[model samples]
Target: MESDLRIAGTNSRPDIVAWAASEDGKVVPWVVIEIKSGASSSKPEFVLPQVAQYASTLGTADNYVVMGTKWFKADRSFRRLEPVSGPTPPPFGSHGEVDDPAVVEPLLTNWLASLTREMAPRELPVGLPTLEGFSVTNEAYWRAAMRAIADTTSRSGFAQHSSSPLIAALVARLIGNRLEGLVLDPFSGVGSFLWAVADRVRGAMERGESPPNVRLLGVELEERTAAIARAIGEIAGVPTDIVAGDAFRVELPMSSAIVTAPPVGMRLPQPYELLNGRVTTDMDLAAVDLSLRHLEEGGRAVILLPRSFVYRSSGDAYREYLANEFRVGALIGTPRGAVPGTSFAGVVLVIDKGDAPGETFVGQAADDDWQVQLGVEGALTKAAVDHLDGFSEIWS
Candidate 1:
């Protein structure tokens, strides 16, 4: 038995991880135990997901969630649990330690450990016990933890509309290394944009250069997602504020930058509805309109839009309006599978609230290394600087 055993591939650590030899002399973690106390000790739901997650992470099927004496025990599958028969010493007392590396590897294929992920709270929680307990000392750990949360959210079908990390990173590159003041992600699903921005800004900060002090902000529609975002933002070590509400209805601050992958097919409600002369409301257009309206003077916004948003002829007025009224810097087309949970190819619309109307910089990123295509000074960047940026124009 080991206390505070760190789980591989993640930052999660479980208490009382006990190991033993299986029937065929294979070393295995026989049982993972989690102990709870205080007022929350009685609530099984609070600890269920955590234990399950730990077990899944360790690849173990047996778990013991103990409040007092043998409170709950999980079956081999860990899909169901029942009250233990009697009070007894935890599995550690009976199991012999497994130290052989050869045997250890196979046992780890299916193991369990203590868990920290709690059930999603019914109300919007300001902080999470597990999140606070996690010691994320560096950017790499923060990134991994957030990615783990993304996997969990995606596995649960919660953040299906969230942007992929690649797209999010590309959007962050557009934000560049000079981030400051307020930054907003209207859609903010699982805080994909905010995380990407934080990562970029933190990298800059590490270099002692730009992004003096950026305040990452977001408005997420789901309570669970917003809750997770707040935790992730805190863990990211960036000054972040995430609110749970509809992005359209919530009063948002005028931001220096806005990055988002807005909903694709949701119908716009009421006076905010914008069709841009099309038969139906254009969600991307509405998102752009809302972002531009919320932007401070000279503020920049990076938005992800579907191919149709840039190609459809009915949106000519809106496109002209963008070209005429705002500084439409670039319209960079991304590789296929840019949008999560869909095969939709998309484009990154870089706009600024500056009072300038000119040709938009445009390009198509390769299947990978899109950041270099969009950022570094190269042929692609040079071409974009001139009036010859035409990746989207030619394709459309």
Candidate 2:
């Protein structure tokens, strides 16, 4: 909490912060509430931009959200608005009128909390009967699998990554709804995307629901990540065919719903021999090209890459390629210092396979309140609820 405020330059002596947690004692990523008195702006005038700056600082600038006070009816009904564009001006409140924290405090907090509330088991997908159903089904099983994988691997300097809960669920829901399912993670660092998808499958089974056939695949040149991914799949009771190869050279499965996280010029030790492949000293355009190719006709994909890819002149050709092959659904830009310990700016691009596009939903997920980010964009946040939904089926 303190670090985030410091990074945003919002830390102030008058600001009293409190930690937030779930009933189960898990630290709610929502972090703390900031209560202050006698500030000239009531709510900090810079708060919205500061939050936007914080988004950029956290590499989630594309997802900008500012929750503040609002008028409430006797029954506590109120309105919450997702900031579409521009900085949220001072005197924050619903309907662009009142700014007093006294009026705004309870309402804002409630609104934020509502956005972070977890789903009840009844609201989740029905449970499956056995390990034959899917790779992941419940929180209990997923944790157990993660722990087992962690146990097998050495602790030192190993990095594991996965798709955010939102991404995972979106794919599952798409599949459940009878849309063709094809997932490709170009920057399959640690197979987070695959795990998320597996978890979604598990959720559907638990809910007594089944999805149409789907294929989950990723490219990780590093052996360590690929090995751990395979092991995780085994532990989760699902069979995953994650190959050890460069994303550019690996053949991607067809369809759409591509979700990936590419490296942002971060120099990390790769655990593979660069055999007969072009090893570039910088970001690989070939990898991006491969991503563009893998999307099936009329499919949509989201890619998480460095912010420079959004505006840099060098990436113009890539952007142009995307424009031709896929409709540019959305472009979210982030500020510097977004990812902790890394200088790269983060951005999420939503793209469709062809000229026609679906409604674009974009929002930043800061360490401050990830659940809210998910709730505010519920349409795009499927992975978060997959576990509760249960796994209905799995293909080996």
Candidate 2 at 393: error in angstroms?
Answer: 21
Give all candidates' CA lDDT scores: 0.65, 0.45
Q: Could you say which candidate leads in TM-score?
A: 1
Q: Write the per-residue lDDT of candidate 2 for residues 1-396, one digit (tens) a residue.
A: 232234535553212222222333322222122322354334443344434444443332122222344311111111222323333322211122221222223332232223223432223322211222122223544554443333322222332344444433433443322234666676776566566666666655667776445566767876655654554455453445677887756666775566676665654244222222334334534445556677777666656667666677755655665565556655544344433235566665656665553334444555455444444235234332232123323321
Model 1, position 107: C-alpha lDDT score: 22
TM-score of each: 0.62, 0.49
Model 2, residue 223: C-alpha shift (Å): 1.1
Q: RMSD to native for every prediction?
A: 12.7, 18.2
Off by over 4 Å in 1: 1-141, 149-156, 271-280, 366-396
Q: Write the per-residue lDDT of candidate 1 for residues 258-355, one digit (tens) a residue.
A: 99988876666654544243433556778888898888887888888887788888677888878878888888887776566666778888887874
CA displacement after TM-score superposition, residue 181 of candidate 2 (Å)? 3.8
